[model samples]
Target: MTISPPLHLFEAFGVELEYMIVDAETLDVLPISDRLLHSEDDLPVSEVEHGDMAWSNELTHHVIEIKTNGPHPTLAPLATRFRNQIRQINSQLLSHNALLLPTAMHPWMNPERELHLWPYDYSPVYTAFHRVFNCNGHGWANLQSMHLNFPFADDEEFGKLHAAIRLILPLLPAIAASSPWCDGQKTGYLDSRLNSYVPNSRKVPSVTGDVIPEQAYTQEEYHRKILEPMYREIEPFDPDGLLQHEFLNARGVIARFDRNAIEIRLIDVQESPLSDIAIASLVTATLQRLVNESCTSISQQKEMEVASLRTILDQTIQDGERSVITDRNYLRQFGISEPQVTAQEVWCKLFEDSRKQISASHPDAIPSIELILKEGPLARRMLNALSEAPSIEELRTLFRSLAECLAEGRAFHGL
Candidate 1:
């Protein structure tokens, strides 16, 4: 299944959004994804196709993933088609008293009891994961994310794209943190999904290089530094050699040289598909300007040290937009001069510059940019709404509001 290439930089991209199936009334995670897939009347649940949209199963039975067929030139049509699929899926699940919720983690569901693997098609790979790493852990069984795939047609494009992604990977959590609660309690980290995800894969140390990727200037370098280490580490465990490909990189941002693309895996799933598309547009447009204009280089002075970058990521995951950017050296790279700045300030400047560059061609994304600037990211909004829910009944009330906004395709304001 080869996807078509994009004509210009940032002009085209693909999206994949993961969502959880939960009971309509109690809102508990429901492992009925397989049953729901076949429950639809007109189509085969294994792989449903509607024009460019594709629906499929994931590692767990409570989760499903929806992806666009190929690179979309515009997000308007993409969001419309995606929302239509969500509506259709929700309608089908209603017969079984369940619905899909857009979130990185279920607020109160216990993954230990609810975790279920897809029994058909590629079950061997999933079985390996379950046996090797105990996939029932919080990182594997309970998290969801939004994946963006951007094309890099050649070696030059891959080099430039890889550099740009590494520079901005740490700050993504500040703008997309949606997992605030886990196991019926506050996890303290705003993007708890990522915090858990990093350590969860550490059992297989070669699989991930933590949140930010190590610098790789060429495909050969990436293959040697990132891919080879992982393959070597897993070879001893899987004598059959199941996990031998580039998919093992597992870094926050990875280069798929085979597909000639770079996949960004840092962003959490937002409340609605529109917001998710909006964030994708913002990131794509920003990277376009950075690479085309040569605004910055991957030099020593311009880059943050690996240690400092990891520390910042940890702080942002805990504090979200409120995290302070106190490193004046790093702040200068983004053109921030304040003695101290918040994560919101960094995103505000990026969005403003990106809007100017993208507005003439793709104006539909402006509202989403403005919404984040004004209302804060989805994570901040969720935290504020959760504050108002003082009791279990009130929490349910707030969640219902959020689920409704997700289903209705609207921005979620505080309850």
Candidate 2:
């Protein structure tokens, strides 16, 4: 395999979206990702490339990931490409009465009973994680997310980009929370995927670290402060060193030194590619403005404490747009003069500030962003489609519509 050259800040982007394969009629988890990977041939391959897009397997057999084949100069065309791939995958899955469903978590999956690890290719690594962390839970087996990765040139670029990412991390879930239900009921937290993700590696606290990354701007500082401690802590459980790489550090946003980029793992996969790409566009544009120091100086951004950010993150994970931001200091970072505001207000300001950049780079995303701002995230829209105590069939009905949204590349706007 050949490696691509490193990308400079904002030069390009790589987005990865994970979806669950489920029984078409019942919406139950179907462990058939390998079947999807091998749909074109008889061999059980782990990944299949299709020009600029590719389909790959995740840790769980019930999940499949679709990603850009490599970094692209812009995010404008990926939704259509990803939608085409989803259509093909759905067509193939028709034979098995299974199709791809989008969301950060399955509404009714009992992970303990239904979890199936991918038993091919990198089974050893999965097995190691299962052995150490017990992958048969909601965190490991029943979570899906959209990973937004952007490259940085060097120390100076990395510092600016990382600082911008840290400031925006808490607000991501407010706009992108899609995992509203788990175990056949509302989990109370809007983004249950992230709420569970924060504690997935509780055995090794250094691995997650409050779900907000430390203020380590440079590579040397990141290695010494974040990476080194995590590697040392997980070394005992992973004695053979299978899980000792940069990937092991599961902070919400992680520095991928190998790729010279940072990947934000906090956004839940939305109901459709359109919504996902729109959220990505908004995030990228906002970060662009911040990196250029349009809103605040790098010094002020770097001064944001982890505890304060984590507190906001926790609130958004639970309440999403409705979560109030009472910290005047945090509000000032984004140029908001209000003493306190809802998470949605902060996002409105960001969208207004970054409208020009979004229009220039991803004009297609404007409508979807407007829809989210007006209606709220997918999780809230889903709740609007059902009663407070919806029945199992009601849940199924709502999610089936979400699956259709994925298939048709249309955003979900309640029933």
1-415: candidate 1 lDDT, tens digit per residue: 9966544445678899999998999888888877655535633256666688888888898888889877776765677777888898899898999988877888877777888888777678888878778887788899899999888767677777777777677788887888887877778888989988888777778787766777776888888878888888888777777777877667788787776778898899988888888888788877776676444554533255656677778888888888898877666656667888888888898887777765876577688778876767777777777663345666667678878878898777653
Q: Which portions of model 1 miss their true places by more than 4 Å?
A: 1-8, 36-46, 298-305, 388-391
Give model 1's TM-score versus the native structure: 0.93
Which predicted model would earn the best lDDT?
A: 2
Q: After superposition, how far is residue 151 of candidate 2 from its true place, in Å?
A: 0.5
What's the distance in Å from true for residue 66, model 1?
0.9
C-alpha lDDT score of every prediction, in listed order: 0.78, 0.92
Supply the global lDDT for candidate 2: 0.92
What's each prediction's clash count? 0, 0
Question: CA lDDT of 357 in candidate 1?
Answer: 62
